[model samples]
Target chain A: MLNIENLHVSVGDKPILKGINLQVKPGEIHAIMGPNGSGKSTLSHVLSGKSGYTVTQGQVTYEGKDLTEMAPEIRAREGVFLAFQYPVEIPGVSNIYLLKAALNSIRKHQGLSEVDAMDFLTLIKEKVRLLEMDEKFLYRAVNEGFSGGEKKRNEILQMAVLEPKLCILDETDSGLDIDALKVVAEGVNSIRSPERSFVMITHYQRLLDYIKPDFVHVLAHGQIVKSGGPELALELEEKGYSWVENKQAA
Target chain B: MTTQTASRYTAEYSKIETTLPGGSLPWLRALRSDALKQFSGCGFPSLREEEWRYTNVSGIEKNLFEPRLEPSDNQIDKDWLENYRLADCWQIVLVDGYYSAEFSVLAGLPENVTIKSLKESLEAGDGQIEPYLGKAVGIDEHSFVAFNTAWFTDGAYIRIPAKTVLDKPVQLLHVVTDPNRLAATRNLVIAESMAQAQVIETYVGVDQAYLSAAVTEVFVEPNADLTMIKLQCESEKAYHFGGTYVKQARDARFNHHNFAFGSLLARSDIHSDLSHGSECHLNGLYLGVKRQHLDNHTRINHLEPYGISRELYKGVLDGRARGVFQGRVVVAEDAQKTDSEMNNRNLLLSNDAEADTKPQLEIYADDVKCAHGVTVGQLDEKSVFYLQSRCVDEETARNMLTFAFANEMVTKITQKSLHDLVLAEVLKRFPQQGIMQDWL
Candidate 1:
C-alpha cells in the first residue's frame, strides 16, 4: 500500500535520513525501533507531508500516486493519518467539532454525502466507548489541558473514527502508562483489517509487548541496520541497542 | 493642551441651553456652566496628552453635530429598532439624546424601583438625582466628561432599593436618526445596600454620520452585586464615545462586560474603584473591520485592604482597521493583599491591520500580587497546521481560529438572549461555515 525508495530527507543544512527504503503491503504492521537521534521522527514527518523538511532525493508512493506532492490537508483527505508524537492543544475548537469537520471533508473528497447528525453522534459515542473515554471529552476543547494518556487515547479514538487506509503512529506509546497502552493497543487491534496498514515508530520495545508487529526493523545512523522477526525485539530489549550497533559495524 | 475648536460648540450652546433638561434648577445650571467653562478651556482631549495619545478626536472638532431639541418619532424605524430591544426586560429608549416615552417599555416594573427619565426625575424634584450626579466620575476627569456634563439633554435613571433583587435586567437603549445629530446623554444607576441587579446599555443608530456621546455613573452600595453590560453596535459611519464609571462600597461586587462591534471611530472608557473586601471584574471584546477604529480604556483602583480585580480585553482587527487597548491597575498603600491581573490580547488579520496595547500596573503596597500580560500576533502556525491535518483547508482553518479567538469572550455571557444576540453580531462580522450556534 505504501513504498519509500531511497528517501533522503534534510532539515535545513543538516541531513537526517540518508537513502532509506521501506515497503508495506496491505494488512501489515511494521515496527521501527531506534535510539535517540535515529531519524525515526524525520521519517514519519516526511511521510505525513509536514513542512520545514526538504526531501532532497527520493520518492514516496501511496496507492501508486506521488504522496509527497499532496498538501497536508489533501494527504489527510486521501486517508494518510499521522498520529502526532505530541498532539497540539487547540483551546477554542471543541473535539467533536473538529471530528465532524474532518469526517465531512474526507467524505466530500470521496464524493459521498455528509454524515447525518444522529449517525455521526452514534458513531462518535461508540468510538469514545471503545477508547474508554468520557463523553464530556468530545464537547471540551481539543486536547486543551488533557493528560498525556488521554491525549494518546484521543488520537487512537480519532483513528477509529476516520478509519484511514494507512496509519503512522509516531511515538504514540511514549507517554502512555501500562493501562493506557493496553487500551490504545486494543483500539488499534480492533481496526485491523485486510484493507488497512500501519507503521509504528517507537523508541522502546515495551509497546511491542501490547501490539505485536509482523516485522521488526532496527534503525540506527539514519538507516535500517537489521531486519528480523518479533523475537529480534526481545533480543534488542535484553542486549540493548549497542549490540545492534556492534553487529552492524562488524 | 487647549484648542480653539471648542469655540464652535460653545458658540451654538446658547441655542440649546434653554432646551436642555434641568434648566430650572440652579445647582444643575451651575454644574453645566462650570463644565462648559472646563470644556471651553480644555477643548477635546488632544494627542499630546498621555491618555489620549493613541486616539485623536480631531474628527469631532471638524464636524458640528447639533443636538435635537425634543424627542421625535418622525424617522424612527420600529423594525430596525426591534433588532436591539431585547425581550423580558424593562427598556428605556433614548432617541437623539431625548427620552422617547412612546418607544419605552416599563410595564410591571416593581413599585419600589425608580425607573424614569432623568429629566422627569429632575422635574419632579426627586432629591436622589443630585447626590449621584458627578459622584462616581467628576467632570475634571477628562474633557469628554466635561463635554457630556455640559451638553447632555436626557438619560435613564435607575435605582434598585436596598435588599431588593431584580427579577429582570434593565436595558438602556440609545438610538440616533439624523445624519449630523449629536446625542449626548448622562445616566445614573444605583444599587442600594444588599441589592442585586443587572443592566445592559445598547447603542444603535440609523445608517448616517452622527455622533453619540454617553456617560453613565454607577454606585454599588455595601454588599450589593451589580453586573453591567455595554453592547455598542453603532452605525458604521457614526462616531461613538461611551464612558461607564463605577464606585463599589465595602464588600461590594461589580462586573462589567464591554462588547464593541460597530462604529467608524469609537472610544469607550470603563473605570471602577473598589473598597474594602470588594471584588471587580472587567471583560471587553472589540472587533474592527473595514477602516473602523475602536479604542477601549479601563482602570481599576484598589483603595482598601483585601480588594481584588481582574481585567481581560481581546481585539480582532481586519482590513485597514486599528484596535487599541489601554488598561491600568492601581493599588494604594492601605490596600494590603490586593490581588489583580490584567491581560490584553490582539489578533491582526491583515497586513494593514494594527493593534496597540498598553498595560500599566501602579502598586504602592509592598505586599501585593499584581501581574499583567499583553500579546499582539497573528494566528499560531502550529495550530493552523494542526487543523489542516484534521482535513480543514488552510483558509478555513485560519477563519475558524480567528472566530474561535474572539468567541472565547462571547461565551462568558450567561444570559441566553443576550449571549445569542452578541453571538449573532460576532458571527456577522466573521462569517465562517460549520460555525453553528448549537455547537457553541
Candidate 2:
C-alpha cells in the first residue's frame, strides 16, 4: 500500500529525516518507535504532505501514484488520513459541519452524490456511539477547549468516519491516560480490516498492549536501526533508547 | 467659516426653515438654528479630528445633495418595499425624507403605544416629544448629528407607556428614491419604566448617488429594556451616515445589532450612556466588497456604579475594500464595580483589502473590570489546513472558515426572520459557492 525510498526531509536548513526507508503492505500494521527528536513526528508530517518541509531526495509511492506531488487535501481525497500529533482548534467551525464537508469532498472525488443532512447525521451517529462520544460534542466547535483525551479520541472518530485506505496515527498515545489509551486503541482495533493499513508512531511500548503491531521498527537519528517482531518492543522497553543509540553507533 | 458642503446644507436649511416641522415651536426653532450654527462652523469633519481620522467625507461634501421635502410619486414598487418590511409589526415608512402614510401600515396597534410620524407628532404638539427628542444626542457632537437635527423634516416617534411590552417589533424603514437626494431623518424612541420594545431601523435606496443621514435618540427609563437593530444596505453609489445615541436609566438594558453591508462609503456611530446597574451589549458586523468603505465607531460611558457593557464587532474586507472599527469604553470615577469587555476582529480576504481596528478602554474607577482586544489578519493557515485535511477543498475550506467567522455575529440575532434576512445579506457579499449555508 505504501513505499518510501531513502526519504530525506528537512525543515529549513536542519535535516530531520535522513535516508529513511520503509514499506507497508495491505492489511499490515507497522509500529515505528523512536526517542524524542528522532524524526518520528517529522515522518508523519512529511507523509501527510504538510507545508514547511523540504524533501530534498526521495520519492513516496502510494497505490502506484506519486504522493509527494499531491496537495494535502488531494492526499486526503485519495484515502490518506493523518491523525495529527497536535490537532488545530477552529473556533466557529463545528465538528459535524467539518465531518460532512470532508465526507462529501471525498465522495465527490470518487464521483458520489453529496449526503443529505439527515442521512449524514444518521451515519455519524453510529460512529459517535462507537467512540462513546456525546452527540452534543458534534455540535461544538472543532476541538476548541477539548480535553487532551477528547482531542485524541476525536482524531480516531475522524478516522472511523473517513474510513481511509491508510491510517497514520502520530503520537496518538503520547498524552493519553490508561483509560484513554485503551479507548483509543479500541477505536483503532474496531476499524482494522484486511483492506486497510495502519502506521502507529509512538514514544513508548505501552500502546502495543492493545492493537498489537505485526512488526516493530526502532528509529534512531532518522534511520531505522533495528527491525523485528513484537518481542523487540519488550527488549527496548526494558533497555531504554540509549541502548538503541549505542547499538547504532557501534 | 463653513466649507462648501457644510454651508451648502446650511443654505438648504434656510430655504425651507419655515416649512420644517416644529418651526412654530420656539424651542425647536432655536435648536435647529443652534445646530446649523455649529454645523456651519465645523463643516464636515476632516481627518484632522480623531473621530474622523480614518473616514474622509469629502465625497459627500463635493456633491450638494438637496433634501427631499415632499413625498413625490416616485413610483416605489410595493414588492421591493415588502422585502424589508417585517411581518406583524407597525411600520413607519419615510420616503425621500417625507412621511408616507400610504406606504406605512399601522393596523391593530395598541392604544398605550404611541407610534406615529415625527412630523405628525410635532404638529399635534404631542407633549411626550419635548422631553425625549434631542435628549440623548447633543447637537454639538459632530457635523452629521448637527446636519440630521437641523435638516430632518420627518422621521419616526415611538413612545411605549410604562410596563407596556409590544407584541411585535416596530420597523422604521427609510427609503431613498431619487438621485442627488438627501434623506435626513431623526427618530425619538422613549421606553418608560418597565417597558420593553424591539425596534429595527432599515435604510435601503435606489442605485444612485444619494445621501441618507439619520439620527436616533433612545431613552430607556428605569428597569426598562430596549433592543435596536440597524441594517444599512444602501446602493453602491450611495453615501450613508447614521448615529444612534442611547441613555439608560438605573437597571435598564440596551442591546444593539448593527449590520453594514452597503454604500460606497458608510459610517455608523453607536453610543450609549449607562446609569447605575444598567447593562449594554453592542454587536456589529460589516462586510465590504469592491471599493466599498465601511466604518463603525462605538462608545460606551459608565456613569454610575455597577454598570456592565459588552461589545463585539467583526469585519470582512475583500476586493480592495477597507473596513475600520473604532470602539471606546469609559468608566467614570464614581462608576465603581463597572464590568466592561470590548473585542474587534477583522478578516482581510484579498491582498489589497485592508482592515483597521482600534479598541480603547479608559477606566477612572479603580475597582472596575474592563478589557478590550483588537485583531486584524488573514484567516489562519493552520485552520485552513485542518479543514482541508478533512477532505474539504482549499477554497471551500477558506469560505467555510470565513463564513463561520462572520456568522458569529449573525447568530447573535435571536429573531428568526431577521436572522435569515441578515444571513442572506451576508451570504450575498461572499462568493456564495461551496459553503453549505444549510449546515451552518
Candidate 3:
C-alpha cells in the first residue's frame, strides 16, 4: 500500500535519510529493523507528514496518491495511522472523546454515518477487553499519568478503533514488558486483514517472535542495506549489527 | 488639587445628596458622608497605585452615570430577563438598584430565614442589619467600595439563622436598562452557627452603556458553610466593579466562583479572612473578546493556626481583548501549619490579545506550606498536533483544547442548572462554527 522511491529527507540543515526505497503490497506486514540513529523513526514521521522535515529528493506514494502533499490531519483522514513511540499526555481531553472524534471524522470522510454513543461504547468495550485496559481508562484524560505499557496499549486500541488502511507502528514494542508485548501483538494480529498493511519499526528481534512479518529489512547509515525473509531477523540477532557493518564495509 | 477623577465623583455625589438611602439613621449618614469625603480625597484610583496599575479607569471617569433612584420598568425586557434566571431557585430581582417585589419570588421560602429588601430593613429599624452591614468590608479598602457605600440606594439582605440548612440556592438578579444608568447596590449575607447556604449573584443589562458598582459582605459563623457564585454577563458596552468580602469564623468553610464574561471593562474582587481551622476556596474563569478588558483580584488571609486556602484563576483573551489577574495571600505570624496553594493560568488566542498576571504571597508564619504558579501563553503546539493527529482539523483541534482548558473550571460547579447555564454562557463567547454543539 506504500511506495517509497529513493526517499531522501533532512531535518533542518542536517540530512538524515540519504537514499531509501521500499514497497509493501496489500495485506503484507514488513518489519524494519535497525540500530540506534538508523533513521527508523524519521521514516515514520516523514511518512505521516510531521512538520520540521524536508524531503530533499524522491517521493512517497500511498494508495496511488502523493502522500507528501497532504497535511497531517488530511493524511490521517485518508486512513494513515502512526502509533507514536512517546505518546503525548493531554491533560484535559478524555480518551473516549478523542477516540470518538477520530472515528467520526474518518467515518464522515468515508461518507458513513457517525457511530451512536451506545454502539460506540460497545465497540470500545470490546476493544478495551482485547487490549486488557481498565474500563476506567476511557474516562481518564488522554495518556495523562499513564504507564508506558498503558500508553502503548492505548495506541493499539486507537488503531483498532480507526481501522486505518496503513498502520505505522513506530517503536510500539519499546518499553513494554513481555506480558504487555504479548497483549499489543495480539491486538494487532486480531485486526489484520487482506486490505490492511503494517510497517512495524523495532530495534529487537524479540518483538518479531510474537508477530511474524512477511519481510525483514535492515536499515543502516540512512539506507536500507539488507532485505530478506523472517529468518533474517534471527540471523541478525545471533550475528549482531556489527556483522552487517563488516559485510557492508567489505 | 487632589485628582480630577476623584473631584468629578465628589461633584456627582453632591448633586444626589438628598436622594441617598438611610437618611434617618445618623450612623448611616455619617458613614456615607465620610465615604464621600474619602472618595473625593483619593478620587478614582490611578494607574500609579500597585493594585490599579494595570487597569485604567479614565474611560469610566469621563462618563457620568447617575444612580437610578427609582424603579423604572419602562425599558425592561421580560423575555431577555427570563434567559438568565434559573428555574430551581428562589429569585430576588433588582431593576436599576430598586427592589421589585412584583418580579421577586419568595413565597416558598423557609421560616426563620429572611430574604428581604435593604430598603425594608432600613425603614423598619436597626435590629435586622445594623450589626453586620459594614463589618466584613471597610469603606476605606478602595474607591469602588467607597462609591458603593455612599451611593447605594437598595440591595438584597439575606440571613440564615443558626442550625438551618438551605436546600436550594438564592438568586440575586441585578439588571439595568437605560444608557448611562448606574446600578449601585449593597448586599449582606449571614449564615449563623452550623448553618449552610448557597448564594448566586447575577448581573446583566441591556445593550446600552451603563455602570454597575456592587459590594457584597458575607459573615459565616463558627462551623458554618457558604458557597457564593458571581456570574457577570453584563452588556458588552457596560462597565462593572464588584467586590465580595467575607469573614469566616473558626472551623467555617467558604467557597467562591467568579465568572466574568461581559462588559467593556470589568473588575471583580473576592477577599476572605480565615479564622482558626477555617478553609477557603476561590475559583474563577474570565473570557474576553472584542476589546473587552476583564480584571480579577483575590485575597486570602490566614489569621490563626491550621487554616487552609486554595485558589485557581484562568483567563482566555481573543481579538484585541486584555485580561488581568492579581492574587494575594497573607499568613499571619500566629497562623502556623497553614496550607495554601494559588495558581493563575492564561490563554491568548490572538496576536493582539494580552494577559497580565501577578501573584503575591506574604508569609510571616514559619510552619506553613504555600505555593503559587503562573503561566501566560498560547496553546501548546505539541498538544495541538496531538489532537490533529487524531483526525481533528487544526481549527477544531484548537477550539477543543481551548474549551478543555476552560472546562476544568466548569466541572467544579456542583449545581447542575448553574453548571449548564455557565457552560452555555461560555459557549456563546466562542465562535459558534468552530465548536460543534451536538458533539459536546
Winning candidate number (DockQ): 2
Question: Residue B318 error for model 3, in Å?
Answer: 1.2
Q: What 10-residue stretch in candidate 1 chain B is worst by lDDT?
A: B431-440
Error of 2 at A21 (Å): 1.0
**Which pairs clash in the backbone of model 1?**
none
Every candidate's CA RMSD: 1.8, 1.6, 1.7
Q: Which ten-residue region of model 2 chain B has the weakest summed lDDT?
A: B430-439
DockQ of each: 0.69, 0.76, 0.69
- Segments of candidate 1 deviating more than 4 angstroms: A242-250, B433-439
TM-score of predicted structure 2: 0.97
lDDT by residue (A1-250, candidate 2, tens digit) is: 8999999999999998998888999989999999999999989888888889999998899999989999989999999999988888988889988888788889999999998878888879999888888998899999999998999999999999999999999999989999999989999999999999999999999999898999999999989999999998999999999999999899
Q: State TM-scores per candidate.
A: 0.97, 0.97, 0.97
For residues B1-440, write the lDDT of model 1, one tens digit per residue.
35588888889999999988898888999999999999999999988988888888888877899998887767788898998988888899999998888988998899999778998899888888998898899889999999999999999999999999999999999999889899999999999999999999999999998999999999999999999999999999999999999999999999999999999999999999999999999999999999999999999999999999999999999999999999999999999999999999999999999999999999999999999999999998888887888888888888888888998999998988788889888988975634545346
Count of backbone clashes, every candidate in sequence: 0, 0, 1
Candidate 3 lDDT tens digits, B1-440: 13677776677776777776688888888888888878877877788889999888777776878886567766577899988888788888888988889888899899888898887788787476778888899888998898889889889999989999998899999999889998999999999999999999999999989999999999999999999999999999999999999999999999999999999999899999999999999999999998999999999999999999999999999999999999999999999999999999999999999999999999999999999999999998878877778898888888888888888898898898899889889989866533445435
Instruction: Judging by DockQ, tell me the better candidate of 2 and 3.
Output: 2
Model 1, position A135: C-alpha lDDT score: 100
Model 1 earns a TM-score of 0.97
Q: Each candidate's lDDT (Cα)?
A: 0.92, 0.90, 0.91
